[model samples]
Target: MSVNSFLGVFAKSPIKPMIQHMDEVNRCAEALKQFFKAVYANDWDAAETARASVVEYEQKADELKRKIRLNLPGGLFMPVERTDLLELVSQQDRIANKAKDISGLMTGRQLQIPEPLTEAFDAYLIRCLDATEKAKETIGEFDDLLETGFKGRERDLVNNFIAELDAIEADTDVLQVQLRQDLRKIETELNPVDVMFLYQIIDWVGDLADLSERVGARFELMLARV
Candidate 1:
């Protein structure tokens, strides 16, 4: 087949919707950061405002997904390098969904972030969002990420982000186990139920980080030529 016969990166396909979806994801990350700040301050009003931003970003992502599935474009430029465009898009969508999930948990739960763990969560969140935002920006510049012959500094950022996230998840796991064991004395007051609930929420937050790391990994796989 001629080189021109292959799919165009900018062609009208699910790629556009994917880009919009990731933008919404990035927005939610920012909203969550602000939400964490508000919660740390114990400012209910600020928290509510930040939560609204999450809702808005969630709605936009939902709308974009709907439009993509309902209105399939005829002339699409998908990744000729990676045939798993649908799978990739779905995985990217999950990152945004998980972000919304974390935000939803914040809104519904009466979470009390421990003073020491607060900094850790903040660091984890910043790293996850940094990885996610980098992935999204790279997507917008799709050509560079999907080249058959081209390769350069992109891998440097992606490699570092992925490595950092792996470490973050490990750190979260260690902190959670240590915290739970140390709280054994107070188990009488809060009981295992309350402790479990708190731990589960923290675990879910780590999952969001995991999803972001997966996004970066997916990009790497898609970029690697067969």
Candidate 2:
């Protein structure tokens, strides 16, 4: 598509920019899987490449966020409350922000997952990303929801997406606790500083799901007002 045509779409539909931003944010989160895989394999070169992709996606999301905030129309004719949509975009932006932080810190330190914890950590990361993916899907429904006036089947489908996002986040919580426990068991053998950073990384990864859940919560609130 031509640049004007693409830009015209956002002018026509406010939700389009938000959906595009979430797409980049989701890409940032999804990049972590490859990143962690390289980290686990002790391949710094491959890990660096994946981390770069994460950074690239994050930058794209950030740019879209700024544009959306600046150009978001303000009028009574808007499909949803302007404030609510802005708030939702803010929450969505954090997912990408946290993803960048995770990859930047891990890659900078050349961090390695402990042998025993690698499997569990990978699972935890995947489940967290799943929550992010679900959030993107949920947000993608907004255009349809607007069409249906936030009633009927489209609304039901959004509610189901939120419920699934909640469940995925809950799974991450459980996995987080288990990973922490397993980490604790091996903490004594690893360098104390590495152990400390590992715990921090664990918390940050969990934050991905936490942030995603907040996105769903924000959308749910928007739905409730209709």
Candidate 3:
């Protein structure tokens, strides 16, 4: 039996998942800021606090996902589009989680960080997070963008944000290579697993930014047709 039919009286979901997704994305922004602060200050406590925030935000996003899946009454709304939105928002939350994971993983571990490179890469990380947050806020304009042409600050901001992400991605590639080379010279050993995990974290961050771009592209298409 269909869950909605089992529950009976299918009606519009009172919860605004779009708004929830916006809030979740904002939470990630704050978490990213905290993550950088923690690293700069070399304080694991701050990093832990940031991680806790990620969990709370993701929990709320997950709740919204469940609500949308069960109560959306397909065909009443843009079913396929709505499903994709939910998935994209979930991806953003996971991106935030990955940042938290990296912070925690490095926490308390004695790492030989080159002072200059450390500062530079940390700044790049913050820029990436900022771009992601802006793109996320753009996604919240689904209703307005669908009705009106992509003529709003949010849409413009997302475009610029994507450009900035492109630059950061390039810089990150350079920094990653530099850091790995430096480490190889100083450290006697490097674990493949740790290297793999670090790669995954960076890739996930990029994925978040990419998902936001996809949302913006879809919003533009929807605007053109609507």
TM-score of 1: 0.72
Q: Per-residue alpha-carbon lDDT of model 3 for 1-226, expressed as tens digits?
A: 2445423433433224555555665575457666656656667777677667766766665565555566655455542355555555555555555555555555535222345446655655665565566556556555454344455775565456556555555555565566555545544455655555545545554555554555455544544442
- All candidates in order of TM-score, best leading: 2, 1, 3
For model 1, residues 133-225, the per-residue Cα lDDT tens digits are: 765775554544444233466555555655665665566556656655555545556646656766666666666666766766676676564
- The per-residue C-alpha lDDT of model 2 at residue 69 equals 83
Residue-level lDDT of model 2, residues 1-226, one tens digit each, is 3446656977678888888889899999999999998999999999999999999999989888888787777773855799998899999999999999999999889989999998899989999999999999999988888888889999889999999999999999999999999999999999999999999999999999999999999999988887
Predicted model with the maximum lDDT: 2
What alpha-carbon RMSD in Å does predicted model 1 have with respect to the real structure?
Answer: 5.9
Question: Number of backbone collisions per candidate, in order?
Answer: 2, 0, 0
lDDT of 2: 0.92
Clashes of 3: 0
Which residue runs does candidate 3 get wrong by more than 4 Å? 1-16, 77-80, 108-114, 149-211, 214-226
Give Cα distance to truth, residue 84, candidate 1, Å: 1.6
